[model samples]
Target: MDVDTRHWIGGRRVANADTFEDVSPLDGEVIAVVSRGGTAEVDAAVAAAKDAFVGWSRTSPAERAELLRRVAAGIEARIEDLAQVETRDNGSLLRSHRRGVMPRVAMNIRFFADHLSSLVHSDFDTRGHRNHVTWDPAGVTAIVTPWNAPLMLATWRIGPALAAGNTVVAKPPEWAPLTASLFADIAHEAGLPAGVFNVVQGLGNEAGAPLVAHPDVRRICFTGSVPTSIKVGESAARNVTPVSFELGGKSPLLVFDDADLDLAVDLAVEQFDNSGQVCLAAVRMLVQDGIYDEFRARFLERAATLVQGDSRDEGVDLGPLVSKSHFERVDGFVKRAVAGGAEVILGGGPNDELNVATGGFYYRPTVFEGVDRTMEITCQEVFGPVLTLQGFSTEDDGIAMANDTDYGLAATIVTGSQERAERVASAVRAGTVWVNCFFVRDLSAPFGGSGRSGIGREGGTWSFDFYCDVKNSVFAPKGWN
Candidate 1:
């Protein structure tokens, strides 16, 4: 796997002496030696973006749209290689990358490209005068993406930022830095002008802090934990720079007694999608007391059947926990839960024998049966394949228990009654609430969180609103003055 793992600045791979190991969670192997950036690298990348912003911001929406289409094509052409390296880099299932992740990268770019072309501003006549409102491109945008589905999330922010005619400097997660280098290559090859999109690869403090705090950066977009987002917000505030964050969650999934049991059970299993490394997955499940016993029985049976091993395996459903430290963190949460009297119905921790056999950072798909809202496993955002269950006697109790958490990112509702579905969806304190299915995404819809989960919404017009400055110019009528 010989590849150019360096900072991408000014349409090329820039070199740096400070480097870090891109370790594989699959088997704890050093996949690549990547350049670790600092304040100097951040300054250089920001300067490059600042230089390109002047020209890029003045381009027509049609021009920006066409270039983005080319970027989407570049991703589609090399989707398989991109998917493979991503699986190798961060321990996500290869099947998911091929099926969803890489394809969505292309989709994210194409959707925003088309959106830019169709975008329309507003104009009105008021008091014998004409007022025209326009979406003006903000200058340089600083984007810091998380490791889980790194490329897809980056493009989710990147597509709109570029479509709105803003230049970008991104700090891809150091845990999975490979694909971002490849993404910058795709952007450059797609005829994106030099410095329009730059990459500074390093840790949160070394590179990420400097990029977000850079005085020249106009807007900041970040996706990761809530604690980190607070620091970002604080840094961005010093310059009064606007920031958009999509942070962590311990979102709830409400299952009513009237719900279809089979569908309910399957949805519970789907929480482990991407090995439960998903932020929106409902790890905290609150079930109506009527169906609690049956749902728990069926859920544990299905959870036990899930295969955990090599992410490259076609039959596997779960993989390693992304890193040794992350594995430890998730395991620590479970240990505390067990210590506090929460019964682990399935998967307390990793199987040491199997872990030694594969040399992979693996954890069993865990479910806690007796966890209350006070338990760490029930309230905290365990970004691993962990589930916590509690029973509620009535609809009010279920919704109340669901909203008890500090996070309000997303939620899932399961019920057979239409009235109940509508009422519960409205009552649930989350940004996005799913009534029946899970992970069904619409590109045009506003996507983000509430409370400690996130700061703003993005997707389609919402993205444009955040990435661009909406301005209005008023003029007197020809004879009015």
Candidate 2:
């Protein structure tokens, strides 16, 4: 593990001529050096996938399903190892990865694999002709994952794409590429065919641009920031290749006066569990006037109890942000918000009490008040453990404030009244709405956003459709032609 991390291409470990340091944000140390794959590596991966596509696509559904099941089992067996690597590489709390992320990864793969048997074709009979509708693999697909949840998110694309019988060439974010290598190992152990799945680790501009723009790649699925996704889309557009995006969000968490205050406070504090680096984190809170003050008090009290330190610490609840650059970015956002008259009700900067020798990129969970809807901090994505509080007088006002952002990835409503919950959930313009909870997800449900959040969905049947192309065949009896 201490050696340089190489690319997993064409069913083997391939080393590049150049390498880059894989720094750990927790200790600000070079944990490992990873291959800096570029156009040549991307080309090799795509070519390998193309060469494997015909045979992989021709594999029976049962065979593919079995392979997927084996992969799932392999992931389960190596859950601890995968979780440790992810936590070390991404600066996520080890407990969070062990209990939350790793299990979800295995479940996501199995969920898609189990559904393969039910993937059926359709038939239609006319007066003189019989027509059939079938789903075919979209050849080779390029999957680009973000640094936040490398393995989990990549599996969101990889599981379904492989289940649909398409070969894959994946590019894990340069920041956290360790678990991706582990995932490739598990896939090979599960008896996946050579060239069916590949991983190229490097910077986005160097490796990602060429992969998306490659003429041989039929589809692209990317999870990252809005700007990066736009660039990915433009590249895919040139070749007329389809692309699916799960982009940024400034998600709102609505706390009605009638909501359970304790639960609201607990969930709000939970936002800092991953230091608020999640795309679906409830970064904005719209509380009713009656409960705004009390909610803010309880939220700050709870957030204060969270322990911030190195991700490897078992007692820590909030770990450092992913990298030094991300730490500076989050710090800058807080500074700007304060300058705009927003009050730092709880935390405003890094936690100095933690051992400095850790050298981690730590940021205390910050809570801000008096934030206006038009302010940059309110409308833009900070992608940090910073929450902006706004009070709403009416239900309409709350809904308006929630949908004010350009991004509509996800939102949550914490209300005791069933009618209010139903009404507000319908009114909010987000892809996923949690009625009484935050970050609750089901693999069967569609997950994506509207208006800059993302381009398409990535769960259950939606995933199946995105990874496959449909074809219609007709048969005429006698002289029907």
**Top TM-score prediction, candidate number:** 1
Q: TM-scores of the models, in the given order?
A: 0.98, 0.97
Residue-pair clashes, model 1: 0
Q: Which stretches of candidate 1 lie over 4 Å from their true place?
A: 479-481
Cα TM-score of candidate 2: 0.97
Whole-model lDDT values for every prediction: 0.92, 0.89
Model 2, CA-based lDDT: 0.89
* Residue 325 alpha-carbon offset, candidate 1, angstroms: 0.7
- Lowest summed lDDT across 10 adjacent residues in model 2 is found at 350-359
Writing each residue's lDDT as its tens digit, candidate 1 over 219-266 gives: 999999989999999999999999999998988889999999999999
Which numbered prediction scores highest in lDDT against the true structure? 1
